[model samples]
Target: MSHHSIEARDLAFSYPDGTVALDGVSFEITHGESVAIVGANGAGKSTLLMHLNGFLTPLRGSVRVGDVPVIKSTLSDIRKAIGTVFQDPDDQLFMPSVYEDVAFGPMNLGLPLEEVDARVIEALTQVDALRLKDRPPYRLSGGEKRAVAIATVLAMRPNALILDEPSSNLDPRARRRLIGLLGTFTHTKIIATHDLDLAMDLCERTIVMSGGTISADGRTGDIFTDDALLDSCGLERPLSMQNCPKCGRSD
Candidate 1:
C-alpha cells in the first residue's frame, strides 16, 4: 500500500474571475500525521483544503486521497475518505439541532438508522458536545459550534480530516479544549490556519504557502524558527512563552 494518505501534484486553481489561487503546489501527507498549512490571508490555504476532498477540481495537475485520484468519477470515494470542516461553523452546521447536524453525514452514507444514531452520539461525546445535542445549532457559542461542526464530520469516520481555521474566533479556554480534542483523533489531519501557536502546538510539520505555491515545508520547529522565510511568506514566528506549572509552556 502507498504511504501517502493524501497527495497533490503540481496543483493549480483559478477563480471564475481569472484570479489564480494555487500555482503548482505539491505535497504528500502520510497516514495519521498532523500537518499545518500556514500563510497570510488570500494565500490559498482555504483553496488548498477544498481541493483535498474534491470540493474543487484543479485547473491543472491532480490531487489524490489514498491512492484514488480525485476526479469527477471518483469524487464520492474521495469525499468519503476525507472530511472537511470549514473556517466558519455557520457554513458547516446548518441543521436545526446539533444532533441532526452530527448525524447528517452518517445518514447520507446509508448506514442504518440505529448505527447513525450511535455514530452521532459517539462523535458528540468525543468532542464533548453531547449535552448540546438537543440545542439549536444557531444558539451555540462560537466554540460549541466549532465542536459541533467537527463532530458532524467525525460521524462519518473519515480517514483524513481537513480543517480550515479550526481554532478561529475562540476564547483561550475554548481554544485549549479544541486543541486537546483534536489531539485525541488518530486520522491524518491537514489544518489551514493563520494561528501560528495552534499550528506549533498541534502539527508536527508545517507547509508555508505564498502566492498560491508552497514555498516551504519542514518540521514544525524548523519552520517556525526560520524568521526570514516566515517574514517573506507574511507569517509571524510563534510567540515565545515561559514555562507554566500547569501547562508547561505556551505552544
Candidate 2:
C-alpha cells in the first residue's frame, strides 16, 4: 500500500452567523507521520479535522487526502481513507454490543462474513478490548468505551487516523494505556487536542493555532519552548517539560 498524505490549500470557512472558523489554513502531513494540532478552545482545530473527512465543506479553497479532493464526488473515498475518533466515545459507539460496533464498518464494506469477523477480532485485540466483544457498550467504563470506539474505526482499515481530544477525561492508568495503544498504530495520525503532554508523547510535530489561524508549526520541543509563541497562542509549556529541567525533548 502507498503511504497516505493530507494537504489543505488556502482553506477558509465561516459559520452562517458570520463567525470565521478557519482562515487561509494550509498544511501537509507526510505519510506515517503523527502530528498534533493544538490550540485553546475555539481555535478551529475541530473544524479543520471535520474538513479532512469531508464532514464540512470549506467556504473556499480545498482539502485533499492523497490526490483526492474532499468535495462531494470524493467524499465517500475520503471518509474511507480517514478514520476519525471524536472526544466522546458515545458519539461513535452506538451499536449495542462491542462486537457489533467493531464489525459495523467492515460489514458495510461488503466483506465476506469470515473476513469481517476476522477484522473485528483483530481490531478489538489491537486495542486490548477483545474481552469486551460480548459486552454491551453502555456497560463499559469510559476507557473501555474509548478503546472500542477506536476498534470500530480500525476494522475499516483506514489509511489515516484523526483523533480529537483523545486523552480527555481519563484516569492516570487509562491515559497511559491510551498513549501506549496509540503508539502501536503505524497509520498517519493527526491528533487535535488541548492535552499538551499527550501531543508531546505521540506526535513529532506540533502545529499551534490561535483565532482560527496557524500561528506556529514546528518540532514539538521547539514549539513548546517558544515562550513568546506559547503566550501568544494562550498556552503554557506542559507540566512534563516544566518538571524536567533537562528534558531537551524533540521529535
Task: Identify the candidate with maximal TM-score.
Answer: 2
TM-score of 2: 0.96
- For residue 30, model 2's alpha carbon misses the true position, in angstroms, by 0.6
User: What does the lDDT come to for candidate 1?
Assistant: 0.90
lDDT of each: 0.90, 0.92
Residue range with the least summed lDDT across 10 consecutive positions in model 1: 238-247
List candidate 2 segments past 4 Å from native.
Answer: 243-251
**Number of clashing residue pairs in every model?**
0, 0
- TM per candidate comes to 0.94, 0.96
